[model samples]
Target: MLAGLQNVTFEFGARTIVEDATWHIHPNERIGLIGYNGTGKSTLLKLFAGEYAPSAGTVERSRSTSIGYLHQDLLSFDTNESILQVALHAFDKAKKIERELEEITKKLEEHTTDELLHAYSEKLHEYEEAGGYTIEHRTEEVLQGLGFSNSDLKRPYREFSGGWRMRVLLAKMILQQPDLLLLDEPTNHLDLPSIEWLEKYLQHYKGAVIIVSHDKYFLNRMVKKIVELYQRELHIYNGNYDFYEVEKQQRVELQQRAFENQQDYIRQQERFVERFKAKASKAAQAQSIQKRLDKLDRIEDVTIERPNIKINFNVDKTPGRVLVELKHVSKHFKNIDILEDASAEIDRGDKIALIGANGKGKSTLLRILAGAEPFEGERKWGHNVDDAFYAQHQLEALNINNTILDEMKEAGSKKTELELRTLLGCFLFSGDDADKKIKVLSGGEKARVALAKTMISKANFLLLDEPTNHLDIHSNELLIDALNRYQGSLILVSHDRYFISKTANKIWEIVDKKIKVFKGTYEEWVEWKERAESRNQTLASGSAPVKEVIKETPKASSNGQPTTSTGGANAPINKEAQKELQKQQKMFQQLEKQLADLNKQKAELEAELSNPSTYADPEAFKKTENAYRQVKDKLASVNADYEKVFEKIMTLEEQQS
Candidate 1:
């Protein structure tokens, strides 16, 4: 075990976080620490990390166990050195040895001695053993994997924002390679690509990891166990988040039955005591039965607390078929080209998820669509379109002196106070919480107020950017449910894959400075992408595809054209094997495209030879004949390569089968 709690009871003032909780952190364990907002999940982590002592019992850790903790608090780190230097601090022993070696070398240059030589040799060996030479390369690799550019590595660390700094610290901790890693909302600062990169890196990590996050999709993919904190107790589930959900529900059902059965027995015992207490013959027996009943262990009724709210978005008017249209859009920052000649259409009822890596212009595109950012493009809104954009500006405009209820009323949703209060409840501002002034609320609370403000807007079309940023798992679910029921057309940017999967009916990706639209759900998009990748085709092809392979819905097993290089593979093949097949298939497609081009050239050459004007000049006629021969020769070579690739593909399929 790396570290754990042994019958530990922890409390914060009057509220108890956990009572007599025992949990073991085994080596190589991937655990997801989960709970509702304000349920003491963070406090439990502090207890396990030894930042807080248990009120009773003990916290256990091995004598040599090393822990690497990543949290929001790490943002306080300040440094003027380059990010590369900061991350290289992980190689402490190696760095010290390097300094000593440098000093010894300088002295040896002045005057040589046997003792100095021996010391220099020993230090050099030590440095090599500590991997001093490759530390910089490894640091740069990790930083780049966390979405840092090569230029950014040489910049001062203090110049970066909190999000970027958090990434640097994460990279450093990753390089440290501790026995266990405790990450609190690690993905909150990461973009889609960085999150995916982190997932892949952690999959092969040797140390144990405990993650506290509200991203259900992340938990389902990364965790092997779930440790839930509820009502001052720890419940362990030996499976992923999805498995825990089913197992927990079954457990609740069984507990409910047990409680009901116990209630029946108690009721019968009470009735017996009441009936016979007055009778002299049975008075003593009744007293004895009452004593036994009083000493019996009673099962408490089970009640699960989940956030519930009604997000009824009232679209005042329906827009035309084409809600918005973009024509020849061009956007750039300095020399970086975000979009150029990008054209896209947002039709009515199209729930689009704009997803990509950081610096791919996701938020910038949202601003462009909202007409808040100036770009060289034409943005046309359809008839009766009423759009409202919600982003960081909403929170920035909040009135700190105003109460939360006042802010909701001033939002102009035209809803009654009861409705507003119920909506606030979903944001975890229940009952008297609505009366609190915005000044007293935490940053998270203020952000929730801003979200509630946006939710109450009467826009027929909504553009939300990272709406689930500060939401807990339950609140995230409530918000997802609300977006699903909303009648208005919407476009949202979120890193939460589950949120996008549940709410988006269409997917939009900005690839190579253009919008690539996929007419399907997020799951369908993933399936399509995998299929395209397996066939050696990029979703964002530079030129036209052999054919458009997209269908209305990919889940129903639809096939489009079923042609080579344009069909989705319905058969389940091993992913690694599919990659090999895809390479061969890609070569075949390229050869086919090449063959088509060659055939077109050959046809043109034949047409040129038939021209009467060519014979008028003997030199031109001779040049045309040579060009035709060259085309034929090239076509033959390409055809041979195509045939070889086709055979290879067939052999691979047979072997895989």
Candidate 2:
């Protein structure tokens, strides 16, 4: 085991957070730690990280086992140091060996002693083994994968935002390659691409990993086992998040049945003792029954509290066919252009999901659509379309001095006290909880309040940005169900794939300063993207080219459903189109070959130029350099042509479909 807790009991003063929780983290295990907010998930991680000593029992870590922990709050970095310098610190041991080798080399230059030479050789070997020479290259690759550019790497860490800084810290942790890695919501700040990159990295990671995350899709992809903290105890599941859900439900049901049966038996015995205890003839027997009843161990009922909040969008009226429309919209922040000429029409009942990388205008687009932000172009709302926008930052707009009930009353003044209380109860605010001051509420509680306000707005159209951000899994499920049952239209921006898949039918992907609309679910979009990538890879590697099959489109039946073609009427193929496709495929193959040959020549020239002997001959060096430059130019030209051809092929295929 890399680390484990032995009957760990932790508490603050009188209140207990965890009690006798024993958990063992084994080698090469990807374990996900899940629990509701304030359930000691983070505190448990700290105990494993040695940042906290268990109040009772012990936390045991194997001897000399290196642990790397990435907290939700990123560590501060040196303002004077560049991003690259901070990342390089992960290879401290390798750098130290490199420094020692440099000193030994200087000493050898002064006097060729055997001891100095031997020391230099040993240090050089150590440096190579530690990957000292290629540390900068690896750092660059990791930073780029984490959404950093070469220019960004040269800038100081303070130049980046908090979310970007978190990515840098995550990169450092991965590069350090400890024996065990403990990550707390690592995907919280990462965009889709960065999340995918991190997933691949962790899949190949040679260490045990324990993560606490609410991203169901991420947990499903990264973890093989789940350790859930519920009711101040640990429940281990031997499968992924989806599997755990099914298994947990079954276990709860079984436990509830067993508890009910035990309760029935106890009640019967109690009734028999109560009736006979007063009778003189059976007094001894009644005493024996009382003793047996007292000795019986009571079984607690299996009760999991679901979120009390009922989120139902109050749709007063249906809007026109087109709920909203944007025409040539463009948004710019100082020198950075986020959206350019983005135009789209949102019809009634269109459940659209806005997705993109961080700072890529997903939220900005939502703000623009909600008429809360200014843009360069026209935005129009359809007739009778009343819109309510739920920005993630809206939690800050809540009245801190007011109570939860007061805040809800402000948004929903028309709601009666009983109705409002019922609504608050659904959101887990009942009686005393409803009277709690907003200033004293936790982040998750504030989020819940904000969401309840939005749901009570009774708007026909909803624009939600990161609605699931601070929600626990159960709350997320409740929100998802609410959205699914919502009769009004919605445009949501969230990183939770599972929630999106369950709610969105249309996808508005903001990429490269433009919005691309796809008429399908998120899963369909993923499949299409994967197919496109596969085709691109085929083109790049000069693999077997995709054949252009001129099959007739299937005809619809009387019911307007597509029917399978078996000796059915064949549609005539356009001969010219067929020839053009073949020509394009052949050209793509030729360009791939040319690019491969040019790369080969370039590599050979680079190798020759690296040799010291080549520099001894000036003419040979000049010739090799010129040849290398020519090949490099040729390779670039071929790559450009190849990209154009590949795009053309993809377009044609898309059109055919």
Number of the top TM-score candidate: 2
Clashes of 1: 0
TM-score of every prediction relative to native: 0.81, 0.84
Candidate 1 TM-score, C-alpha based: 0.81
For residue 381, give model 1's deviation from the true position in Å. 1.0
- Model 1: how far residue 403 lies from native, Å: 1.0
lDDT of 1 by residue, 1-657 (tens): 888899998888998888999999989999999988889988877877788899999899998998898988889889899999889888988899989977986876677666776776577568767877568768887998999987899999999999999999999898898899999999998998899899999999999999999998899989999999988889999999999989998999999999999999999989999999999999999999999998999888989686455688877898899999999999989969999998889998999999988889999999999988999979998999998787875676889999999999998889999999999988888789999999998877898898888888888899999989888888888898988899989999999999999999888888768887777788887887666555433322223232222322133223321111222334444567556766776677788889999989888886775554554444575688689889978976897788688777665553342
lDDT of 2 by residue, 227-289 (tens): 999988999999999999999989989999999999889889888888989999988999998
Clashing pairs in 2: 308-426, 308-427, 309-426, 309-427
Clashes of 2: 4
Stretches of candidate 2 off by over 4 Å are: 75-78, 278-281, 307-309, 394-396, 418-433, 439-447, 542-657
Q: How far in Å is the alpha carbon of 148 misplaced in model 1? A: 1.0
**Model 2 Cα RMSD, Å?**
6.0
Local accuracy by lDDT, each model: 0.83, 0.80
